[model samples]
Target: MAASETPLRLSDRAGAQAFVQNLLAVMSELESALGRESDGVRAGRIAEAMTGAAAKADLAAAYTTGLETAKANAIALARFAPEGLEALKTAQRRFAAVLETNQQVLATARTVSEELIKALAEEVGKAHTPTVYGRPSHSPSPYGRAGANSGPLILSRSL
Candidate 1:
């Protein structure tokens, strides 16, 4: 069998408890950060959302590390304290729900931003398009002739 497929050895009961506690702590922090981010986006406070980005990233990393440690020690944990394992499972379910909500909020914000940019681009194109001159008193096209031949609009998405 490949080394990667090999199972990790079970940790002692005390170590298992510590690992579970640490995972719970990181998960709590992650949940808080996600809540703040969701509220900021809902309120249209870009600055508030940006402020939590770094913290969220850090907490997410820590949570992942803790989960991996717990998995390696799962056998020991099950033998030592089944109750602690059940609590961790419950916390995981709660975290998943919050994560789903946060994702929906972020998706909405992105769609709104994209629509606003497209509207702005169209307006800018119309304004910059040159008017075509007509012979005598003939009326020009509602959209300037130049507008029809304008280059494709390019949007810069640095955000």
Candidate 2:
């Protein structure tokens, strides 16, 4: 059989558990960051900041979950493989690669999210800004004072 195909000996259960525990810890951190982001958004100020935080949190959470799943699958392979050692090693490498890919994706997501939020905030601010013929006014409507034209107009006729 090719060396690549040969199975590897399985590591101790304790080692697998340790790896899993580490993955869970990472996941927990990601969750905490996401929670903070949500809270910031709920506060309703500093929208751009909130969006950036939320995006970071989202990407982190996704990466953590993905890496956790990959680790779990690797552990299962270690348990079931007939050629234990080789299979375990292969699984471990595969899981590591997955983790790396997830990290890259997370980073990209964070960047994109931040930019999107900033652009949205800018657009909203522009849309809501008051327009004035003279000095700026805080009135809701730009055209004139509220109820100014509510009364009927009087007309004078000259023969």
Candidate 3:
């Protein structure tokens, strides 16, 4: 028979397993038949054909089982719908918004603190100066020079 004219066979895990089992049974039957045959050449040829067919069936069975396992894994992954991804995206957007707000508040606080320090330094400059070793000296403001102090300290007082 021509290769194209032959019927195509497809098998899954269970079908492949069944095919392998049936092929083994057929091989046993063929061996028994060959033993009964009187012509040695015909018997040897039949045994060789049976062996080749069994090997092909075994290879096909392995391929089918591998395909079935891959199909099952793909199906399991598909079970996670788009909704899960959408929920994760929504959470990420909310987190981004919160982070942006925190950054804005920090920037505003930094600007206000800088202005407060500038105003305090100007006030201190206008205050009285002490004499140290016959030279003029003044008590340094906790805010330091123009750009010093690491950060502002928040002190709480109970009313």
Candidate 4:
């Protein structure tokens, strides 16, 4: 495996407890960040949805480090910080729920965007089609024709 996949060294019960505590903290922060991103995207605030990416990336790294330490010293943790282990289990369940919700939201966002783009494309195609009768229908662009092409929309699938 990669260097980052290597388990962290653990010398004692205290180290085990620290690892669990650190993982718990990471989970909490990640949960909050996911909640914000999910809500922001659902509400169409795309910029707000993207504000947590950097924070989530850092938290993910910390989470992995702590989990590596925890998995390597599971026996030691059980012997020393059994209560902390229980807390970590509960936190994991809650985190899992948050992740599920976030996943659903992101999936919905993708579907909505795809459908919207397809519908818009069809409309544009129809507008440009030659007609035997009156003028072809034309809808005013939201950002104006020039402004619409000023930048591309970027959506990241990762949280």
Candidate 5:
């Protein structure tokens, strides 16, 4: 059996409690980071939001390790610290919801950015295309320009 599934000695119970506590703390930090990222994206500050990536990655790794330990020590944890186990479960649910919001916000940012770029490109292409017979027959809009199936549209989504 894993340590979590095994019966806990007194010493092991203390260790298991500590492990659960650490996991909870990490989950709390992750929730905060996700909240910040979500706020930044909502406010159109994606660069600022991206700054949280490293902190999120580090906290996620720590949380994963602590979670594994907690699982291994589940039996001991339940026996010695039922309340802490329940708290961890609650925190996990909240963290999951925050993560979902973060995903939605980031996706919105990506879509808005792409649309803005496309619109700007179309406007600029229109300005540069020489007028033919007093109309922009050669200008590029959302539709293809004259004499071309469609002007080259290159998009770099590295962001």
Candidate 6:
């Protein structure tokens, strides 16, 4: 019932055409879901991005099942739905492109979040470190000193 979903008729008579068409519909809907998530994350609409996650998961599962079924009956698909198979290939290529974009968007968001947390951690570290002449006691690289004690940046759970 999603925007890109086409109702499926999975009867034996429907055959390859039905499978290919339904798979395409699922692929399209999944792409739409990913695009919405990417756009929402880019615009800082995090909640909106997550709203259709369950639906996306469902689409992904359906797509996976369709692929498995089609692979098992590749001969049937090739013989009965050659055109549909070609269309599916084209759709799959386009879907791959969308997935790449979605990954890049998510990676960018993760990098920005890590940077923000690092900045906050550094600020907190500064407040606690001993200082001399308006400079922190611990230099950027503490490896020079013998037995220098440095530890990983551990943010509090309260953050």
TM-score of each: 0.75, 0.33, 0.31, 0.76, 0.73, 0.77
Order by TM-score, highest first? 6, 4, 1, 5, 2, 3
What is the Cα-based lDDT of residue 56 in candidate 6? 92
lDDT of all predictions? 0.79, 0.51, 0.44, 0.79, 0.78, 0.81
For residues 80-120, write the lDDT of model 2, one tens digit per residue. 44354364345556556555554555566568667876787
Better of 3 and 5 by TM-score: 5
Query: Using lDDT as the measure, what is the rank order of every candidate, best first?
Result: 6, 1, 4, 5, 2, 3
Per-residue lDDT of candidate 4, residues 48-157 (tens digit): 78888999998877877677677877887788889988998899899889999999999999899899877876666665645445765334587665223323444455
Please report, as a residue range, the 10-residue window in candidate 6 with the lowest summed lDDT.
142-151
Query: Which runs of model 4 end up more than 4 angstroms from their true locations?
Result: 1-6, 132-159
Model 1 agreement with the true structure over 1-159: per-residue lDDT tens digits = 235755435556776677778778889999999999999999998676778788888899888767776777777889976788998999999999999999999999999998998898878776656655732232356765534555677766444
RMSD to true structure for each model, in Å: 5.8, 17.5, 31.6, 7.5, 5.9, 7.4
Candidate 4 global CA lDDT score: 0.79
How far in Å is the alpha carbon of 85 misplaced in model 3? Answer: 1.1
Q: Report the candidate with higher TM-score, 3 versus 4.
A: 4
Best candidate, lDDT-wise? 6
Off by over 4 Å in 6: 1-13, 138-159
Query: Which has the higher TM-score value, candidate number 2 or candidate number 3?
Result: 2
The weakest ten consecutive residues by lDDT in model 5 span: 1-10
Error of 4 at 13 (Å): 3.1
